[model samples]
Target: MSRRHVPAVLALVAGALVAVPAQAAHAATVQVPCSVPDLVKAINTANGTPRADTIRLARGCTYKLRAPDPVNPGNGLPVITSEITIDGRGATIERDGQGGEVPRFRIIYVDKTGVLKLIRTTIRGGYATDCPAFPDAVGASCGGGISNNGKMRITHSKFTGNTSASPVFAQGGGIDSPGSAKSTISDTEVSGNHVVYTGQEPESGAAGGGISNDGPLTITDSKLSGNTATVTPDTRSTAFGAGIISFFGTTIKNTVISGNRAFAEKGTARAAVSNGIPADSGRLTVIGGAVRDNVSDAPGGVAQGGGIANNALMTVKGVKISGNRAVAKDGIARGGGVRVGPSGTLDLKESRITGNTVEAPGGTAQGAGIDNPDGGVLRAERNEILRNTATAENGTAQGGGLYHAAGLPASGTSTLKRNTITDNRAADGGGIFRASGGLTLNGDVVRENRPNNCAPTGTVPGCTG
Candidate 1:
């Protein structure tokens, strides 16, 4: 999580970009050799200069990417304020393999307002084989990938097999961009990246298996799959965002967020796995994308917004949220597929919330595929929400397909129309549960669903009556 605010420092760097002082403005493309020895020399040369320079790497193999010592203070002071472009030449950069130390340094670390673009290269994290005790609690210390605070663009690149240890308390495991920094990633494949945090269970913790975005980010035409966000019980909050954690004003269009799993029981809860958009913040729009096959474990289980945790004013149109599961029994759990928070109203139209489940075993609690409060209205039109089941074994339960509860700081409401709700089962309100307030269903079908405890004892609609 790159949430540090340093606008003044970045301003100074941006100011220098205007007038490059003649002698330094020339297009000086310095070709650094393909080895560490030659690359260091090029960096030293760029540091000594007082202007913008371009260090173009050859089209071969580079053992590692070297950088100025961050702790030495003024060790690479000259290059810190200068603008440089380090471009790879269709090469593969691998991390160094030594003792406990990770092999390669981060691909790029932006301290100035410089622009860095990585094209046609495969940068891999170092192989330490040793999985750290906790990967999610401290993600900043592990830098096998890249960290950017300045404006950057990554095109036609692939990031795989990257790992982050517990570096700083709650940091982004891969590609952390905090504080007013704008980053755009296009045509990229980020797979097999992992954030491993040791859970109290010794094998759990929520790591942002693929990428963590603490700042405003825009991702288009990308695929994030097979990423694991896990948490062990010993930790406080292990999981926040599994595949991607979009902070304020995050937009993901024409992308696929699938096969991302956030496992608990090793921990307590998981928030915003596939699309971790803020609840009561800015806008998080998902246009033309699919969120599927994301799962959460027991105990802490998974809560709300399985495909996305939107606590803010969310409008999801032309999207599909399917095959998501949330299971827990100890305490209370809601929202198997999606969960809306207080001061949040989710307007979903032309979408599908099917094949989702919420089960509680030997416990007293309620679970729903889409959990909405009376104060928080979930308006669904032209949507198909069916084949969803909520089971509360050995205890009283409510709402299997949809559950509407009111108790937020603000008043909640749910207005559903022209949507099909069927084949769902629960102890109470199997098709739809309207606990209180307003539940307006116009032209919607509630058939073939079971409310095991319907009509109670003396009621005419009791069970089979």
Candidate 2:
């Protein structure tokens, strides 16, 4: 029992403590035959625990929520507050109908403090209707299938037949993330989702039938198709972005946004993929993507940007924008391919804007290929603007190839360099229309357009028949 012996013993104990590893965070794995209640219990347990958990569903099984609490915030499952991962193994999670109507609730809701990851799953038949009791205060009735207010990552997943309906505003029929939530989706398919608004005014309409992101969202290798946003008996309301509406910045790569519809029965409908609303500060960057076969129809009102509506900043490289239509039954129709609104900016390179049409049966049609209206700036290089049409059966149709509207309080400018503009049809300015803004045409071949190549308005150098 010497002092040196005591020091040696203490050293040995410290070395033994270091050799023993600290207890690792326990991860629970929940297996198949997962009923609604069982899934809810697993999620709750994971949220209450201190570590991440995994929930594995049986292959091809469909876990349906038969009866859900209509007024609760999260109906089928409790709000997720911790890190959890759900591996579906090609299974499906759906909300069943009570009587004849789908349950008015979302399938999964992630709270602000939660983190959820979904892989290889199918989410279908979720309906979020009359949600957030105080819709005006919340500003969202969204995410019929999955709503994330936190961080979410989805890979190899499919979202189908999800609907977000509200009397006021409905957004993100498939997935909704607002405010500082971050989400990354890869190799996913968002299809057959609908965002419908029955409100009387256009300001209280629906948007983002497939996905609504007010936060930062990145989507890669994804397909958004057969989605719709509709405003019924529209009264100046805008039903836009059938594929996606990013109120904040969004990055999309290797994506296909096709066969989407944004239709307003009476009011203004705009864009298949909208970067941001006029009041929001956002940007859209698409690299190697295709936006085609989309329609924006405001039968009794105005229709704009059948393919894309950029109210903020947009940069598109190596993208194909084709076969889009903007049709108005009574009002104006503009930008069948792309629309750059006031204070908006667009930088397009190596893109194809072709076969787009803007039809205004009773009003004016402008910019069938590209529209830079009122203080918007567009710089397109090495792009093909061809086979576009702006037809006004009763009114004027201008700028079949490209339209640069008169700058009102501010001046809009467009620079088309190294572009081939041809075979377009319009009442005036068949090739290019420059009203008040400056349209700079450098190394652009404007030819073979019906009626004339360029309108004699603004100074467009290098424009000839």
Highest lDDT scorer: 2
Tens-digit lDDT track for model 2 on 257-362?
9999999867878888986532344568998989999999988788889999887788999999999999997788889999988767899999999999999988
For model 1, the superposed segments whose C-alpha errors exceed 4 Å read 1-33, 39-90, 97-105, 126-144, 196-207, 271-281, 298-302, 329-331, 364-368, 373-377, 395-397, 450-465
lDDT of 1 by residue, 13-86 (tens): 11112222233647567877777667666766765676767777788665463333454211111222245666
Model 2 pairs whose backbones collide: 202-236, 202-237
Q: Rate the local accuracy (lDDT) of all candidates.
A: 0.56, 0.80
Global Cα lDDT for candidate 1: 0.56
